[model samples]
Target: MFTDKLREGSTGPVAKFLFIIIMVSFAIAGVGSYLTPKMDFNPVKVNGNSITNGELEQQFRLEKNKLERQLGKAFREQAKDPAFNASLRKQTLERMITDQVVSDHIFNSGVVISDDLVKNRIREMPEFQVNGKFSDAQFRKVLSLAGYPSPLVFSEALKGDISKEIYLKTAFDSGFALPDDVAVMAQILSQERTFSKIDIAIDAYKKNQTAGEDEIKAYYDSHSKDFLLPEKVKVSYIYITAGDFVNDVKYTDEDLKKFFDLHAELYTIPEKRTVSHILITGEDAEDKIAKVAEELKGGASFEDLAKKYSEDSSSKDKGGKLPAFAQGVMDSSFEKAAFALEKTGDVSEPVSTQFGWHLIRLDGIEPGHGADFNQVKDDVIEQYTKVQSRELFMDKKQIIADTSFENPDSLDAAALAANAAREEGGQVSKSVQIKTSDFIANGDEKAAFPLNQPEVQKVMFQSELRESPVNSDVVELGDNAIVVVHVEGYQEPAPKPLSEVHDQVRDAVLTAKAENASGATLKSVTDSLAKSESLEKYVKDGLIVISGPATISRIKTGDVDAQVASNVFAMPTPEPGNITYKSFAGNNGSSYVLVLSKVVDPKLGADSARDSFLNNQIYNFRYGEDNQIVINSARAESKVEYNENREYLKMQEEQNN
Candidate 1:
């Protein structure tokens, strides 16, 4: 659902990385070398395959551009925040890893997704619909508009998603509960009650005394387990990207002319028209269009006619000033009629289309023109170079992969093969146990040892890594570099020293002690109020009684606190001077004392308020509990490995701070 609005090329790190690797491989084998590593191009290795920095940078730019459009003025400001950028990087990496995991699962399970299913899913999407039905033209047009490279690629993506959904459904089906259980929960939760209540303030105890040093230290000693620190990593990185070279590039006048001559079609502007309309509805729409056209022919006001008859609220009020558009941008019939008008102030006779009929007027026209050679030369050159770079990078990466796989033992052999295959100025570098974030920041990681990305953590901690001479998987870091890491060393997490968390332990102990002291006093005060018949007596004893015996149901009380409300609703009617009830403070530190005054049983009621309360309680309890149960069950069944690089998480936190 979140990916719905995104264009095909606008992907998170992992998808981009995968795409780049595949494309680069294809390009390398097909075309000669033009890619240069010095030109802000880097590669992340996964298993034996490489995802180029160039590809990732391109995808990142596309995504960034999309975000900029959405964010408008704040784009530059938001982009400058290091923490925000890090978060975006993390999110991209996580998505990529999750996708890889899902894809792996799909392959392992042998879940088949047919081409028809992908087609059906695409057809069902509203973007591909015309007149509430699937249209091939609309499908192709929408895909093109969404930047989908090809129908085959889009279909494959859909199939992957469908396969994942199917896998989830299969895995989770047994977790769903029966209707009877849900209904019984609904009935039980519907029961209501009338009650009296009072508040037991924790601030009442502030006057007691300040805690002593000895007490604080003792508390700290007892709560050291709660203060244990998570493992952390310190990382340094350098980033290389295509945009870095954009300003450095220059195109001479001669180069521009040559480029323009070679790619003249790219600069040729299509004929464009500005059209306005007075649309009318009803079965007699054509007759209305004809009448309006006749009236306009006789010098009747277009503005008045549009305001009177046009159903298009957006343009009709403005005398039908439609936005300027090029040919192939509008409905076929409408486009044809609008473009046919050669002169300004020309009006067509009635034109019929799907939405009804329109009396069209061509307000202006822009005759097509070829772009000046100097004006677009730089852009043309950039495009040509990018294409060349893509081909070169792909071929070089594949050679590395092939050589690495064939050798199957030495990274030196692989590196040698990569170097041999690379074009002029292209080079390969390696780092082990390095974080993906670091790789993204710095184009090379040779100075570092042991790549420590979250994706690598899985392999690093795996038992297989100990037995095998080499282990590798493609890791998609943020900005589209697919890294294939070879696990060199494995480190398991161990408990941190007590000295490392002395201050943290002290703070935890102090908070716990404060809560216990305040909570005990609050509980005593509430217990006294619940047991006493005279709420005024409790008020006299330094507690506040909130009087007005309102009929608050368990549902309303449940919203306050489910655990506390449960205890309150279970209480017997209060007796004079008797006190023994549980009390606790809410999240906002507001303590409540509930005294049972009356109980109402289930019955057929015309009372909408009562019915509504019951319905809410039933839905909340059953649905909430059932959803939790399903989630727990799914989590239990799945083999999830956290393997989070705490060092990376720490680095992110440090940057944020």
Candidate 2:
């Protein structure tokens, strides 16, 4: 809102003194050294601050890597989908923008993370530590590998994450729903609907009628478009894999070392604590805990006390041994006590938690650190060689696709250039309609080769066949594999001849006529009931009356289908004299006449695990809503200019979930 400029080179002492103070103030705030890397493209700008394409690309890479790791080969299919990729890219961009907005808010609000805290946080990070202690050399090497130029850049980013976490923690912990909130959720979860339903068996109606040959033929003629065949393609293709190039690609020892140095962070593990406790419960729990605490003070073994007094059977037999885990797994009071111990065998005073009173001990601590280069050189070399091959493969993938696209006749030229082998692949539809295994004879396995799967079956069907067979765009199979196909033959889609589909047409016609006849009866019966009273008289004539869940909550459906529950909940509460009635289809080939019977209020008497769990869920939900509100409101209020060229991205993101 403000900008300062000296009045035409004024040489006054006051102007010089004011300039000095401004410099000193910025130095004190530690903002003088904070530098954001320069980027040339701005896709999103908020309040005059540009969020560059480079920054968004980095976030996109991180998100893609995470998806690939989790989903494996399935992610390749999703990545190739235009809708999925567009949505993912937009989400990644928006999330990064939100983070930037929050970071800027933190800075403007003067919520500073001290230099000392940043130092401690960096020291504590497992990635940059060596043998549980901070290593400057290790830190530098790891950061450089991750593309951080210096400590200042990494530290500033880390500080932002920490500051945002602190603020969110405060917000999350402060949220508490009113007593009515629990009652509302309980009513939704536990509400019961007394419903009267009637199943119309299609078979009963079909028994009196049979579909004639002429009728089946007429039905087939009308729905001919539904049976249209998918286009098929025949091609000869060569497959190139990283494994095929692994032995051929040469790398020096120095190159292996360089690869290892850059990716050092991958080797580190987080600090873990293995602690055990003797849990005490029931009326004499405190007395038992006190006794155990006393025994520990007298140098009595924790294992012996645990075995004698522990009520937890899972660990008591093994002297209260618990598997190692990082913090956040245990109950809060227990974790606080356990993590407080400085060394192995350091025991804690008996701590009381939701589980029980307990005597705790720190069995061991494994300090996290990156391994030195010598310890993992061979494995690193093998992995790095694969990485190089994948890189080489990616570069050749486009060349193969383009060369085949231009040539259109055969894979011979592309195969020779890409060092791939040419093999014949069959023409098949987009699905498992044609099985490769079916083509193989039991005794002639050596002569049968499995058909190559196209990159995207949908795209293959979508692309038109040229007079001269054209090359397909490269289809990537996960990270290391890719293939391009050239059409050798094309098959046009046509309706199936009636003789082969006669049985299917007969079944379809029977089902259609039966459902239509039964549906008319159902509609007439259900409609008349609204005009008359006493549904019980019709109960003996095969009407099914089922009671809905007792009390419905958002998370649980007691007896009714979730869709039924949701529809009913959305309705206005009925007056005492007039009960609400809704008619709908049931899961079975049936119709339903539902009445909202009652709603139950939740009764959470005294504090218990159930209460804790419910409150935690409520808190998290509200916290998320609160976060969305604040961030969205802030974003809405800010003047954001989006590049028109990239607005297609926003359109795709609007398809969220």
Candidate 3:
């Protein structure tokens, strides 16, 4: 079990801030710095083999950018907070590290995915198919569109992904068990005991305790390091969106026609036909359907009769009208009959189907036609113009980045270069402060200040403020544009003084002291319960004893806390006087103490369902345990190095004073 331990009450606002700072600092450092002098940008160095930094960064950025785009401006803005970004980076790095570890282990274990398997998997992919069969053209087109150099490389990457998935599955497969084992386990798990439990309420203990100012101050002085705040910055930024470009571009008739001529397939409409049906439901309804078919053949009104009896609510109200449908949209028998009709207003005989009987009418037909240039002109012009504008933006941004780097002193020179790249008659927007911080923080979302986006954020954070005044590399923003960001400002985090948060420190100390006292009280109660043996005696003596054995699984049971359940399962089997302890934080400055009775293991041959249940249980346990072993081994083998810069730590110490 990957149990997440809750932080103790010693955590204060200042301590939390420091934690965030350290996490963020580490995250930034992970991406920006190498783990060891001998190691390059690789996240993992396994027995001299490395997973390069470039590969990890590329994958991370691609995934990050894809998410930013999908979430749009609102969600991107929410994700843009420095603290959020820092957390995201940490999560990403941790995942990368974990993946690298797993990958290294897999390789060392000699697990391999064959080329034949890769090919078979690719064939199974729906995207590489047309008409339910794999198409080489489609496969190549998709691979090209995705920027994969070749099918072999793409297949190899997929193989690696598949191998990792298989590895994990093999590791975690233990959690499931056979039905027989489950039945036996359930019986043992559900077996009721008459014993009662005396919970030493932490809240009661806390209410009895009182802390003086001197005691609180003394606690604070001893644990002052827990009260120091980390450095933080407040920033304001603005961002210009790519969608804004849609409003500025104009579509001319000639441009539209040209676009349509170049991409005619996009505007072609597929053949479609309107259909209607009347269903008769029951056993042997086919005989009744044939009689209706005969009546239709005799020219009985299809619409009037359908209205009186049609079971399909969608078409019944609209005179049995169904909107135009193409192949595969309707049932096979219905579709075959509907499409076989030679002309509009054709009616089919009552047909036998899973729905019983169907009297289908073909109301209208729309023949497939290649759209005329004039008909699709506007759409073509919009698409082509946007594509052109995007290219133009990239070209202009590149010139600005290059020229600015070459001539570090003149902002005018960069602007002129940018303006020069634009087409004649095209108006240029005001010069925006393009900084890497803006792109990093805002992603694709509009920023409060233009320079705070990720593209800008990267440059601002990476470039030396004094030495590298301008960044020359073109920062690509999706497939739309590439923009260069210039560093405008720099701010370093500073620690806050102890006097600023003395009261907060005092409160934290009090809470910690209370928790300690409560823990001690809980231990005493549990010890007493063990000595007494009968929980009924404790209840009679005034303590409340809550009695009931709970049914639970590894997958959380809603009634009990997950941590509590985990701890309970870890205890030894029931024997009189045996006691186990578990604690959890509670609401309103309170805590919970759980006194556990020994678990009763099920008899192996107790149930007829034991075999199946045991199988599943064995599988689940083996998988979970093996996975943990793999993870632990990987962690132990990998190396992690933190930055030596103690400026933040020093500030924290000063603040504590």
Candidate 4:
């Protein structure tokens, strides 16, 4: 559920806007804002604001960790490539630059976020909340764990983020899609283009693309790093789950009462009303409703009068009866009248609403009530047991953490210490057991229980743990589970021998050769087409096939090659009696030469759903584009400089080759 919420928070305009602000806050704060002092190298300066190397390194690590958690094994593979690492570093620095510029712009624009708002925002985050309410202890604990020396520094960083959020919200909210704008966008998006494609399959070039033994061997020797086995680890762990202490908990009647008193709202059910209404709409509804109310006051059976006079088709036949409903679920006026009744069978006076007039009768009332301790004793005990069990779990968790840290080499001491503490507390629970796992590779999706979790994987694969096989710090799997893992076996990545990977190297060499041939073929074809050579000759000679002259829209391209269709639609339409030609390589080892023949703009008919979706898409795109333009303009206008000699930014000599 938390993962889903985080995913949701990473999407849409406001979420994305807040995400950027938060990332900026992280870049500025660098986790331990209070502890960070002056640094020697300032990696970059935005609007004369220096971004120190220390801050950049921290931000880089944060981004790298987030990416690893998100991309999992894919990121591990990419990390092997020096180019990928270089690009990531550059991208991280660029993000910091963008953030600094945007922050400066927002503050200079006179946007203000109050201290109260910042405090409230912090309070609202789930990380600092306990039982749906903000906890000061939790807040301090989380911040301390996150390496913030104090709340003041984090608050300062948060204020800046909140200010940016307010500025972005105003900017985004100021723009909206007009009907005319939406119509024009719809016509353009739904516009059709007629184009022809010449597809040169790679097989034609691959026929003569063979690599000699020496060439294959040379490639294998040079690119040995690319064909390495992933690093693997086997771990032994001791997990403490909440259930381990639940059976050890003992609760009395007094304890249950205390728990019930503290959480009475949890057991309290909302008041509900089973109501019936005679709705009189149309002309003279007021007089008609009054007459019905008068008849009800005259002691006529309310149901009979409703059946005879009510005009609500859905309820009139059923004696104007409605399902039981609670407050906030009915029309305001209707709910007001229905809930005001003191007892069942009470009839309300005529009430006016947008639906005209309603004369309501309360059929029954289920008044909201808080359960007494005796009434919900079992429930109270269950909750009490859970609370005590969690408290006990925390106690044991602390012991495990201390003992594991002290031992550093094994979990045997941690388990014994926890169970010993449990027995000292007069608990009769089973001793915690040490569980061993099969060899798990870095970011292995198939890793079994406990190890399957990303947080565990992260700690298990930490370089320090691999370098010196030791007990890791306690990792919380969720609210109920905590674990301490120790590396029992570790394997470093090594290149595959030529004897084992010869076929793979030969395939790579052939693929490279085929790619080169495809590039050459594309250049020759493009040159020929540019020189006004007839495409009919290539088709007649069976060198390429002409796929389509079919008219296709952006969303409705059918059977046309994806790359060909994409290029065709993206290309500008030619003037009358002229054609535009574009050449590009296909992802499927083929080359494409596209001819855009004609364009047509066709307006869409009235479709509320499609129109709404398109309007939102257009609005989001334009607003996001506007925000980006603002950042770009600011960056361009700002005095931005980078440290040329920064070690992290430079590619290693080996990678340079």
Best by lDDT: 4
Q: Rank the candidates by lDDT, best first.
A: 4, 2, 3, 1
Best candidate per TM-score, number?
Answer: 2
Could you tell me how far off, in angstroms, the CA of residue 568 lies in candidate 3 after the best superposition? 2.6
443-520: candidate 2 lDDT, tens digit per residue:
232432223332234333435533645655555544455555555555676888888788888888988887777677
Tens-place lDDT per residue, model 4, 479-542, is 4567789998988888888989999998888878877766766677778777867766656655
lDDT at residue 469 of model 1 (Cα atoms): 52
Local error of candidate 2 at residue 65 (angstroms): 5.8
- Per-candidate RMSD, Å: 16.7, 13.8, 16.5, 16.1
Candidate 3 lowest-lDDT run of ten: 648-657
Task: Please provide TM-scores, in order, for all candidate models, with all chains considered together.
Answer: 0.42, 0.64, 0.51, 0.57
Give, for candidate 2, the lowest lDDT window spanning 10 residues: 428-437
- Candidate 2 has an lDDT of 0.64
* Model 3, span 115-222: residue lDDT tens: 888899887665564433667976885665455657876786688778876777765555466565566556655643222233544444445556677776676677
Per model, state how many residue pairs clash: 22, 13, 53, 0
**For residues 99-161, what per-residue lDDT tens digits would candidate 1 score against the true structure?**
545555566667888888887888666455443366786577555544555687568667877
